[model samples]
Target chain A: MNSKSKIIPWHSRFDLQGITFLFFLLLCLGSFPALEGSGRDLDYWNNLKGFALKLFPPDFSILRSTLQGIWETIQIASLSTLLASVFSLFLSLGAARTISPLWVVSITRMLLNIIRTIPSLLWAILAVVLVGSNPLAGIIALTFYSTGYLAKFFSEAFESADLKAQHALRGLGADQFQAFQYGLWPNLRPIIWSHCLWMFEYNVRSASIIGYVGAGGIGLHLKLYAESADSWNKFSLVLLCMLIIVTVLDLTGERVRKSIRDRLEGKSSLIKKGD
Target chain B: MRVKNLGICVEGKWLIRNLNFTVRQGEFLAVRGSSGSGKTTLLRVLSGSITPDEGTIEKENLNSNECAMIFQDLQLADGATAITNALSGCLGRNSFLSSFLGFTAQEKKQAIKLLNLLGLSDKLNQWTSTLSRGERQRLAIVRSLFSRPRILLADEPTSSLDEKWAKVSLELIKKDVEGRNGSVICSLHDSHQARDFSNRELFIDSNSPENWSIQDVESKKS
Candidate 1:
């Protein structure tokens, strides 16, 4: 066995790729039946068009209030993401296999897995219950949700990093902290910044919806506008604001990514040496 | 440092066995063997990164962490500047808080001097990722020398350099370590280099671990 030789089935009548595609196609068809009882499928488009007609000339009357709501949503997203990033970094230092003992890694991973298993909406609902439905509830909820995801991301990244430099540092008499700082942190910085930025972007979108659970974001306004028939146009304005913010956040992330790339490539930037 | 009956078994194969040797102060010991002859493994053991399956190592006048290594792979930090890679050697000496304040002026000066000696004066602020293979190899050497260790373990340290640079670098290392009364145990494939720089040669037979032996370079030549 030279190892490079590719192994192929000697003789097989089975069309694996074809059958896999067919299975997914049939699965999609089978799942469509679940939507059968809704009965409004034919009228759904007509209802949307009618509702869309009410959204034109979005109510400028509530623009000021909606802007405030959006600001509050942005605040929730930013705070939660920052808090989650810091907390997750701490968690991952214990969870990463290279850093901690087996028991600590197992316990930390299990805790993150448990948190991740819970739905973000459920977390928001729980936060509302515990903290009395304030913006703080949204902060608490998103922090937990993002922490679960970020910990797993960071720990896996840490594990996948080449350990050669780390071993050399350790052999040269560096403590574990120094090894991480000088050896691993240089390579891990971009990945960490990218994850944090992504988390922040996702939180911005999520913050708007958590208010449905009374966790305090623009979703509370969305819920209020939906219930009051006369304010349908205002709902359109709120959605528009969210869309604008999401786009802006995406553009900002792109800029940050470019700068991080520039820094990594050693083009310029006197932001201190060492990665 | 001394070793007795040193053996390392990997996956039930004896990579090295019945090895007995001493690296006396100020000695330049060159280890020569074929590829996969356990040269790197032996240096790793000396550097304390690998535990020997069977051996007793004796050390004197040096702490466990006082050994520095120049790895064959260079093992430089990809995102860090060349200067930073050199300064990282001092991590064992400085307080943890000093990392926040950056390396001291004296430390920076020391690293710059080493970097310059290794022909990396212009690459001090260059990212390690951007350096050529030879440059990176030199940077690794500078890093190993930065610590002023009592023991220097280098594995194929000149593998990436041209013949001239290789001999020049080896000469510098030999001169410096011997001046400090430090011992150097370096793995090499080039027999001429081993003969030129080392006082003694340790040979490992990859085909038969039982044939491992140490000899004076002059005796072998004679």
Candidate 2:
């Protein structure tokens, strides 16, 4: 407590984080090649203008085709997300500390980590070989991708839930499985739904791109149009369609998430009202 | 049930050692000690949360299901209502699947009845977190009883409660235990309250390892 006993004054110590951040900034600045003439880097702007001009005056003629592609993309994402959620439900339970023991959880975690590390594009490519170049391949790929992402979140949710309640349930003689059902799952329901909705939104975008590798859907069509010299209009149409799909999915996902959150909050409040 | 020669150590230093106690049906034992004394640890051992390094315990009459504990913090699920939380105590008897699907009507009714008896009928569906400290403690005690355990172990159940609630809670606990013909072993920081409530008292003096003396403290008013 004495000033004489103070080994290091708080203000005198050098913060390594600040020094490291400055070093990183200097490195980035050093690597930047000076532009000969800087008038808003014309390439990105040209692409944007070209895209806008070609896409706009709104092609109502191509609307039907674009809507079909968007529909197909959504179907792929929705089916894939549903399947992935089922897989994640079981896998996460195995991975969670509450349900599974150490070795089981660790091994399941390692397997999920390996699966997650492989990009969904690679999974699509592999699925194309196994299941042929079709929408099924895209679905399978997205399913695997979502499983890895969702399972990790699900397990964390399980562990972060009120452990005291779980302990009380276990102490009362509930088996591990029962403890999960009564104590853990109810608490995780809203969180899992939120993650699931987010995954669905992600899958919609992923589904569009997976077609680039010939896994079948709007991406394949977009690639076909983009490669053709005269079909820049079609390419523009596909991009517009993908954008619309993403926007719609994002909005709907947000709505669903908000609704679920509100319902859960209302339930909690009602429970409080009883008190 | 008997806990023989129980010892507890924390990081090579012993907190309590060679503790011996036997609890029988319908008997009430109040463990009284100073703040730093090992009353809570002894209760944990009695409740089967801690195992002794040196001694053996025997449960001659009661099954594992016949043991329940009320933690000092109450440990009630704040998100759950009183009836739901009380019903949780009976989770030991039901299968995991059944409990998860939610309790049956009969079970709910029984839990409601129990809560009603504890003067919590009005708050049966109220979240435990909204309950006052005294109410939460009472809820936990009721939950422990719902487990249908032959022996109930409570640790400082009335520590957070006011004098009236404390007296009421202890009376409820005593009456409930007697009605079931079950034993109760509780640790109390307030010696006067312990003397007033429990039929018998065990005073803990943890001066040195393996040197504790369980004096027969009088529970009667002086």
| Top lDDT hit | 1
lDDT of 1 by residue, A136-172 (tens): 9999999999999999999998888877887788888
lDDT by residue (B1-222, candidate 2, tens digit) is 787887787667676777787776777788887876787887777767777666777878777777788898776666556777788888889875677678888888888887876678888877565677778887888888888877888899888888877887788788778679988899998877877777778776666767665544452444
**Native contacts conserved, per model:** 0.48, 0.38
Could you say which candidate leads in DockQ? 1
Model 2: per-residue Cα lDDT over A31-125, one tens digit each: 77764457564697888887767654544576687778778888899999999999998898899997789999999999999999999899999
Interface RMSD of 1: 3.4
**List-wise, what DockQ does each model earn?**
0.38, 0.29
How far is B39's C-alpha from truth in model 1 (Å)? 1.4
Give the per-residue Cα lDDT of candidate 2 at A273: 45
TM-score of model number 1, chain B? 0.96
Tens-digit lDDT track for model 1 on B1-222? 999899988788998988999899999999999998889988888777789999877888787567888988888787788899999988888877887567988899989988888888888887787777898898999898887888899999999999988987899889878888999999999999999999999999878987987889988788
**What is the TM-score (0 to 1) of candidate 1?**
0.85
Error of 2 at B216 (Å): 7.4
